[model samples]
Target: MAFSKLELFHSLILVLSVVSVQALTWTTTPFNPPAIPLAVRSPYLSAWLAQGAGAALNDVWPTFWTGSVVGWAGFVKVDGKAYSFLGAPNVPGAAFTKATQKSSQFTSTQSIFVLSAGPIDLTITFISPVEPTDLVKQSTPFAYMAVSAASTDGSPHSVQVYSDISAEWVSGDNSLTANWSTTTGNVLTHQVQLATQAVFTENNDHIQYGSAFYSTTNTVGATYQTGADVTVRAQFINNGRLPNTQDTNFRAVSNNWPVFGLAHDLGSVTSSTAPVVFSVGHLRDPAIKYIVAGGATQARSSYFWSQFSSPAALITSFLGDYANALSRARAFDSKVNIDASKISADYASVVALSIRQAMGATEITISKNSDGSFNKNDIIMFMKEISSDGNVNTVDVIFPAWPVLLYTNPALGKYLLEGLFRYQATGQYPNKWSVHDLGSSYPNALGHNDGRDEAMPVEESGNMIIMALSYAQKTGDNSHLTQYSALLDQWTQFLIEDSLIPANQISTDYFAGSLANQTNLAIKGIIGIKAMSQIAQRLGDTSKSANYSSIAASYVSQWQTLAASSSGKHVTLSYGNSASWGLTYNLYADKLLKLNLFPASVYEMQTAWYKTVAQPFGIPLDTRHTYTKSDWEIWTAGIVTDTATRDLFISSVKKWASDGLSTQPFGDWYETTNGQPEGFRARPVVGGHLALLVL
Candidate 1:
């Protein structure tokens, strides 16, 4: 049938409309998480969209993980009519029609949103590349926001896209005066920073000493402006482009609300138009302050500093590597989805949501050379024990978070442990057992020289030994074990003495308070002894290995009698409390390391017991409370022999995640019955959710 060009265009528009209606349906699976990850790369670069009922991107502002607003806004002009797609709510002179969000979905490394603005459909993707094997890219601390617009009505239209970030991203305290400037080279950058830099300090979990960069490629039709938020956005709204001017009025962030804006003009847009990409990052030179082996505090820079000459070069490289970065991220997301879905779709969704939150808590750093360069070989990764306590490189925290690192890249686990090993090897810590954490406060890796760190003797020592061996087992690298042999032996000795009958102490679930003869704590110590046996065998100390093996065997035989309930149904929370049961997640290490320390009957018994006592969300941490830790639940699920039992545990947690009980980040601690967050949110412990895949 021959038709006129106008008739053909109308027919194509009808077909596209039908397809768009089907594609626009939201697929928020497992369910819509309480908060969606936005630009979550490192701890300081982290941002999230707090989810509310029917929450669209245009209406709600993105916030830091600490719940402080990080003023980022996006707008688009189609045929000279402005529409809001991301943040800015009320501009005095510019009244923008809010775009209708069509659909949203999150994967392991990206959050994607589709919105309709007039005749165009905009696809916004937030990509925080998780390059585990590529330290240079992974340590860059930059996240990408790529926006693409296409004609939804099968007709061409003039389009211009605008995005801006306020000075509030530089300092948490809005009253602090901010300074900003624009630079043009390979990339156009708007750098905003606090006037007064306070190194190694944080205002409400926001790094107070870094410059925040909002940058884009220096392509044709790209323009930039920095000024009062209203003035800058109003100009873009009125003219469909920025003025390419920088405001010299440096003032408090809250005074005039300064914003750095960039705009791109696409003269005519169709379905085949390319995406415009923007990069946002925070950079702090000498990112951490650490006490060295000789008890002298030294400044450490992020590993990216070793690769690039300056922050500008680093950002330029990151901007240039967008295509490769997105490819790698998509590959990673696909692998996570395929592997996790083999268990259940619910498991896949939970695992997808947890990757960024887990990796976001860590920073890889290196020592600065005397010549002002960086020494890359002296590298260590530090993690903030976030939300619960701001401790640095906490042993127990890493123990739970280690599974994800092991599943992704074993080398990361080694980097996390290196700082702790260096601190203890220097004899700075006086504790007979392993130190609890590198420092009580974050960004300051000061050793607990006073020996006043929280006492989790059996817990921390066991966690250290198990994690060290787990890293070696996964990577077939034992140099770390050989180098730290003395400290390992010392911790093994402490475990041998106190493992069987643990004294009154706290486990990682310290909020539940201390208890004597904790069955779970004792089993972890027993497993640590067995793990040390393997470590000794790998190091060629067969005599020590045999002796440790014999001791571990004897302890397990006695542990079976002392820890089991009289009904033989499950292990008790403590040695003699028959009526009190808990998730014996420590058993996962035995399975993970291929150590047959416990019999198959023990696994079956515990799996069956979990089914009987399961809560609406999942199993509780213990009989003492109705609250559960998601990390431990997944660890327990990973070790269960029954497929249905494992799925039950996975599906239950998925139910809680979709329940919208808390709008904070993916929390590890929550009440099992109602799925309410129990204080802890956005902690790296959710990395333990990767347990099923790790096995």
Candidate 2:
């Protein structure tokens, strides 16, 4: 059916109406909303400063000391009552530094550091004190360089500072410089790149990555107070890399630099015993080192803001502009596989709707082919980074959206397919299925390294194959499928043979502990096989297509025989007779990841089960946990044809999105009920946030 502007506008209104009503409303102390930087759109854009893991929005405080350090925590204020809690932990000084390092179970860690302090003491700060602006920003004094390395000249060979921002690098006694760049509209980018540096060192010059939040009570004239409800937590980089344990050697002096004109000589002391000193030395070897942080750095933010922010804003600035751009995009090549109307809506809706989630994440570029023919292919999505220098290719991170791109822009869909297919085609893996991820988050695509327990190979392969076919179907083009035939065949072969799928193995949903009889895994396998057959048939390979088609049809029979439930819902866990199969089973069965195998009645039953499992924020993935997968909930919503059911799922997504603006940026996953973002922001999974448009 040809979609008219009226029809498109109607869908837009429906999405906006449901979202505006169901989403949580956090009024600034004076009932005004926070000042959201118009540029960013991601999971974090929703609720600006609420740090609770659940959706209970509370006030936070940014504790800036007059000395060389700052801290943040949660604060609650009632008419006659007052409360304070450590809302988030950025750099926690232990007993080794705090009380007794032995008594701590630092399951979580994050940090922000100052790489090169200016002549004056440098300060960094954040806020969330329930003011007109959800998160308030400030500057705090630069403090302790927790980890450092020295050189022969007593310069900073390398150093690691634990402050509001993180930095690791090797510096000589030479002049330390800062890099500052900016663009209008992106407030997040404005703060990140202001007074930032771009020195590439292994340890000392690297920026530390963590979450920074604070609170405030707004006064009448756009002024706010340093309130009690602020908090800051440092996020540690757990990229599976081996940890280092070396004593720090900080830079002690600079003979020629003016900043050292009258510098005090505190001497070469290891502990924080010195009053103050100028330290300079390479922290570690300058050759082939990674001064890693938890997030994006200045340069990275600039690149992303230029590419994503400007274009997004142009679309939203005017309705005619949006329609014209969409028309131009479609006119660029009629052969593009997605519907123009759908893409238009997606572009419009994401900005109007999901802008907050997009802003809180990071974006980076990778070099693929030297000629740059595939420049678009090199655009990598970096989740939340400790600083602005992080990349976005991680394993379990692929869980965001299978169809988000399919609905918005087919080119993006092509980009996703190219990334996955290119990784698998690199001959990096021996198995027929693909590996978990290309590498750690926020860097280049290092070869897959999750090893055996890292990724559900079969699960990802099936997902890729199915998604490819869906893209082809939506675009009405069989070119992409035809081009990647060999890879698809290999994946299908793996499914039929090795994918008996051990009970204890990991599935794409990494957090769900290993399950023996994972019905969802079985469903994914069935759908994948069918997709492959369809792809083969479209490519005109009848015999090969029929071979897989026959297998898939037979598997369907077996699946029905094995997965049927007595209660009319899909069967729960396959093996654990004692396992409680709740909404996830049916949602997987009925909604999410359109295998196109189930009939309408079957989907109806599945949606019914989801209704039973529905929590305030969303439908639960299973009875095992109340927290839900936000993207998956939207994916599941795609299965039903009923407008009400679709609206329900869309409303749930808006609820999470509303929380996202103020929370964290475009997280891959989050807690279901309270809408707290879980792990990995700006990761690729947020692509799933676009699932509804495809429907």
Top candidate by TM-score: 1
lDDT of 1: 0.88
User: In candidate 2, which residue ranges exceed 4 Å CA deviation?
Assistant: 1-352, 355-396, 449-453, 476-483, 498-502, 575-579, 582-595, 641-644, 652-662, 665-686
Candidate 2 Cα deviation (angstroms), residue 688 = 2.6
lDDT of 1 by residue, 278-376 (tens): 999999988888887778998888898877888789888888888888899999999999999998887999999999999999999999778987788
lDDT of each: 0.88, 0.38
Locate the minimum summed-lDDT window of 10 residues in model 2. Answer: 99-108
Pull out the clashing pairs in model 1.
none
Give the winner by lDDT: 1
CA RMSD per model (angstroms):
7.7, 17.3
Q: Over 4 Å off in model 1, which ranges? A: 1-26
Displacement of residue 237 (Cα, Å) in model 1 is 1.3
Per-residue C-alpha lDDT of model 2 across residues 1-695, encoded as one tens digit per residue: 89753345346545644554345332211011112121122212212232222222112322111011112222211111222222233223211111100110000010111111211111111111111111110001011112221222333221121212211111221234322121222111111111223332212212222111211111111111111111111111111111211112222212111110001112232322211111111111111111122221222221222232342232222222223323342342232223322434323233222322332332223332444222433433334322222433333343344444454445444544555566566565556676655444333344443344265766777767776777777677776687778888888887786443434567756576777666667767767777788888788888988888788778766666555676656556553343455433223422343445655666676666665555656666766677666566666666654655555665555555544333343343556667665554434454555555555
